[model samples]
Target chain A: MERERICFTLNNSPVEIHCHPGERLVDVLREQLDLTGTKEGCGQGECGACTVLLDGRAVNSCLVLIGQVAERSVLTIEGLAAGGKLDPLQTAFVTEGAVQCGYCTPGMIISAKALLMEKQNPTEAEIKEAIAGNLCRCTGYIKIIKAVQTAASARLEG
Target chain B: MQDQVVGSSPVKVDAKDKATGATKYPGDLRVPGMLYGKLLYSPSAHAKIIGIGLADAWQVPGVRAVLTANDVPGHNGHGVIIPHQPVMARDLVRSVNDVLVAVAAETMAAAEEALRKVKIELVELPAVFDATAAMAEGAPLVHPEGNILSHHKIRRGDMAEGWARAAAVVENTYRTQMVDHAFLQTEAALAEIDDGGILVLHVATQYPHWDRKELSRALGMPEDMIRVVGGSVGGAFGGREDMSLQVQAALLAMHTGRPVKIVCTREESFHAHSKRHAMVMHYRTGATGEGRLTAVEATIIGDTGAYASWGTNVLRKAAVHATGPYIVPNVKVDAYAVYTNNPFAGAMRGFGAAQPAVAYEGQMDEVARVLGLHPFAVRWQNAMTEGCITATGQVLESGVGLRATMEKAGSLVGWDVSKING
Candidate 1:
């Protein structure tokens, strides 16, 4: 089996790697690239655990093959913060107790970021729609909804 | 008095890593000189292993080793409360998901290809799929010990005398679905024998200590020789408690003398992992004319499936909570755990109480409707307080939040008596 040479920018860093054509982008990033910040909840895209912004749009990294991402820019949970400051959504999640087991937090934060990037003031129903795919069993969704509202308000003020 | 951490909600310790994707799940782990393993599952539900032809699979270029029951070298089984399940089927395959052969290869694709090439000869047997039929006379026993796993009864007071004094009676049956944990992460493990020949398992499990004990016993190895590490779990919801892909991975690793990675696919995850018991419960309750409870009785039957993982405990929990949040003076409960050929049912979130809660709550609603009383009023009147005794004969020594929960839920749902009148 020959390892294919692939080059891509990850979290603002440039990297070149040799991988099989069929290797999942999630695996290449985690195993070869050592960018473990993007999770693979369900190998299938049913759960949004591996959501990463590909060219500024949220996509399931598990479903994307490494060969498909050649020369493309990928942003993951590790790239959410610019410099040393925590992203407002991350701070809001921590303060509002939105994270329970935190298995769904990274994806939730990414999904919320996608929503806030497009709309500064999303309604409650819109917020629910944004995170409907990322399921959290512990918090019963009350606090997560509140966290999204808090982040939306903070974004509005800024 | 200090409040315990159990009641107060705090951020889980693993929350940060999980949130930042920094937590290393078993699937994410990579070991030095590690090999990928894939098991050849029996397609037949019940069968006898005539023979296994491993030549073609071994011929695969990257295949490292092929293991069957002969390779176990140990007890050859693992069971939670009973030793009924074989790690790999010896001569008889009891379930459709039984692993007859295991293969390890350098790449996952090579391992999967090798798995497809492994040949198995099986003779089919009559199997039982339902609990009631399995309990009947002369049903094909799934286990050598027969279909009946465990039966528990809680008889507190005289049911005949209490029912005779009642003004109204309500009898109902309820059913709960077989819900899966569907934890974001599937079952995965990385097993390797260290330089000292010690097999250390890095697994995604809720019970790390228990896995060590069980793995040691099943592998017929010293407990000290095994170190079980709990990796970043996607979520358990009670699914990861049973031995899913652990024992096989460890055995293959130990045999090949290289690290082994066995990660279950989603479909395999659903079939191998334990699911919440699909239960059928019968409830009979008698109350006074004023909607006050007099006595309650219940019969709960649980399908233990293949092994006694946590079915007996689940049955007891269902019986204890059969009366729900109500205050009943006389209670008689009988809970039965029966075996069937269905997928193994064991612990899930809410334990076994969720099944009875729905049933008992429905029964309470029936009682209220019969007495022409408001449902909330009937519930509030009979709700268990802090000093109340549970159906299990255990006193609530601390906080009993049924009434408060009921009131708050009623207020939130707009359960106004005024609305009922109109």
Candidate 2:
């Protein structure tokens, strides 16, 4: 097994790592860098529980190999908040009662953040389309859609 | 007093940590010198094990150990109510998902590679898939005790006289298929020998104490030599109630003197755990022209599959709730939990009530059509009120609010008055 050294920007920090080229990015992030926030729900790309921002686009980290992440910027759930203040999306989710069991919360928030970053005011259908990949069994999508709408409005007011 | 926190919405205690990806589940656990374990399952639904060859698997680089049923140092049986299911297949495998072998190695890839090297020889046996066919005289017996696991019955007033008073009758059969829980997180467990030589297991299970007892018995270790702990679960809709990887991981860890972790893939999770029972139900109901109920009869057959994992309780509940919430003076219900070589059936959200409710409610709709009465009107007329006796002979002292619930539902949906008159 050969280890290749690759440099990449992670959570606004530059880092270099030597690891297997075919290793899953989710494994590298969790096992090597201690970034266990990016979960691996299905280990396949079907479930979006391992969603991470790869150069401003949401991608399933489990499907991305370490070699593919070289020279790219990656963002995860840990990097969503700045200066100890919770992200508005995170707060809105709590206020709107969108989270239950909370296993899918991080991935859902990441997907929602990716949507909000691209569009200022997404329609209800657009919001639904954005999160169609992430599955939450408890909330039934009513409170989640409401929370996304609330976050978009709060962003506009701010 | 006005409720302060009872009705008010409060944020869940684990919401923040989970949102920030800080909460750790059992799958996220990792310990020093930990080995990954991979299990081999039976491919045939029913088979007799001839022998297992493990010399090639032992030769694989980084492979620590390969274990089979013979390696289980204690009692090999494990089940919620009945000690019938084997931890590993010894001589016979009644289901396709029965564990055959387990391999522990330094890495997951090594463990999987070693698993492919292990050879298993099995003689295929004639399998019985249908519940009714399984109970037939000539069908293959899933268990030596015959195919019928248990039967429940509920009888009320004279069925003949009640049917004689009815103006119309409706009879039909309904069937439901097995459903998987499909939770976000699959089954996962980590086992390690602690400082005091006690095997500590962290798993995603509904019952940690029961897991400890089962693992202790299977490993031939004293209860005090094992400690089971549960972490934050992702989602468990009664699917995590059964044992998955707890005992296997503990055995591997104890044999190799290192931590062992096993995480089931989504495909393995579907084959490994218990599922909701598939039911076939027959319902017959007699009602008057004025939409009053006279008699009700139901027969429910539940295919409990290979093992009796809470099947008897499910059959009992199905029999008790066969007549629905209506007040039927004359009723007879029969429910049977039959064994087959299909997937094992166990606990789910509604247990057994959901299946019979579909049948009884569907019969109500048919009865309404036969009497030319509105659906809501027929249900409202026959709905049980306070002090009405149930089919099981239990008197409802209070809290019989079916009529009120129907009225509210009808109002919310805006029932058409003109259609009812027509």
Candidate 3:
């Protein structure tokens, strides 16, 4: 198969790549772009492990074809921090012991951020709805819900 | 606040990497000159392989390697507990998802195309779908040994005497649905024979060390020859403990002399992966007129599916914990794991405890209702505490917090809410 040049902005930097037309976006970002923060839970869209901000909306990168993301902006969990500082949500998650197994954290953070971006003051019910699709088998959502509420309050107080 | 960590909650060690998309999941591996691999599944639930035609697949462009049952160099079978499942089907395909052939190609499309071109001829046979139906006389034999996988029984005291001494009795049945691990990440692996003639397999699994042993045995290769590195698992929930594509990819990579990557689609993930056992449980409990517990009896039927993954263990644990945290002096429990054509059932969260939580709690509610006693009052009268002996005769030496958990829930819900039975 012939390779094609694909252009996309990952995190905050513009990247140009040549890859097989059949390559998955998750693979292209991980192997070619070296953005491994986007985990692959299931190749299908069921698990949100490969979730990323595709044009500012949380989407599973594993389900999207590389060609589909040509010239689009992608923001992964790596992009959440600024200047070596943890994102407020990430900090809240860590402090509240929200992350267990950690497989669901990245997707959870991304989904939570998507929720916060849409609603500045989301109720506890709203936060649950946002991360409901991103399953965390270990923590059982008690601490995660607390973490989101904590982050929301932190944002509000600040 | 003296720099605590363990119970105080530290950020998950892998959280940053996982969140940032810096984790190298098995699916993210890409090797130079690597080929994609796809498995050819058996169409019939039970069949005898009369012939296999792979010439058409071999002729397909970009196809690098094709493998069958003849290719396994080791034990030819892989099962977590018993060696009943074939790495690749031999003379007979026991279930509908048996692997008949494996193909590796330069691209996934080519590999899938090659798989489609291959032909397999099978003689269909009778199949069984139910555990009890399979156990009856003249049922289709799933295994040469028999249809019944294992039976677990626990007896603590005389059931007839316990019932005779009781003033209130509650009998009920409960069932749990089949649940998948539903991990976001599907099964995937990248493997190849290195220059030193050793197999390097990069895969995602809960038990990496266990995979090293199981894969080595199934591949007919030395344990040292196979090296398994745990990848960034999206989520496992005990689903990735068994074999998936690691052996087949390694086999293809060894034969083709190139890196081989195999990624199962979501539908394939659903098909190849084992699920939580669908269980039907029958419980008969005896209680005092004032809601004090007397005795209990439980019989469980577990659908173990095709191969015994952890079904026996699941049944045993379920039988022992069938009485839950209740203080029952006399208890008798029997649990059975039987074979079926359904998807293989194995460990999931709650192990076997989750099944009885729903069942026994419902029974507790019914017992309270029959005696005109409050549910919480009834449970508080009989709930186990520290030093309580379980139905299996195992004493809870520590971490026996059932009474505290119930009390906390009670306080939080308040006294009036506790009496109301749902």
Among these predictions, the greatest lDDT belongs to: 2
Q: What share of the true interface contacts does each candidate keep?
A: 0.49, 0.60, 0.62
In model 1, residue pairs whose N, Cα or C atoms come closer than 3 Å (at least 3 residues apart or on different chains), thus clashing, are: none
After superposition, the stretches of candidate 1 with alpha carbons farther than 4 Å from their true spots are: A1-5, A20-22, A83-85, A137-140, B1-13, B416-422
CAPRI-wise, candidate 1 is: medium
Best by TM-score: 2
lDDT of 1 by residue, B210-321 (tens): 8887788778898999999886777788888888888899988988889999888877788778889888888999998878888898888888787788999988888888
- Tell the DockQ for candidate 2: 0.71
Q: lDDT (0-100) at residue B187 of candidate 3?
A: 87
* lDDT, model 3, position A31: 67
**Worst ten in a row by lDDT for model 3 chain A:** A35-44
Q: What is the C-alpha lDDT of each candidate?
A: 0.83, 0.88, 0.82
How do all models score by TM-score?
0.92, 0.96, 0.90
Cα lDDT tens digits, model 2, B1-422, are: 34696778887777777778888888788888989998888888899999989999999999998999999999887889896888898999999668989889999889999989989899999999988788789899899889999989999999998899899999999999998887888888999999999999999889999999999989999999999989888888888888888888998998899999998988888877888889999888999888789999888999999998888998889899998888898999989999999978888888888889889889889998998888887877778888888898889999877877776777779986445534
lDDT of 2: 0.88
**Ten residues in a row with the worst lDDT in model 2 chain B?**
B413-422
> lDDT, candidate 2, residue B280?
93
Question: What lDDT is reached at residue B99 by model 2?
Answer: 91
Candidate 2 lDDT score at position B35: 92
- Candidate 1 vs 3: which has more TM-score: 1
Tens-digit lDDT track for model 2 on A1-158?
79999999998889999998999999999888888778777888887888999998888999999999999999888888766678889888888888776777888889999999999999999999989988886644899899999999999999
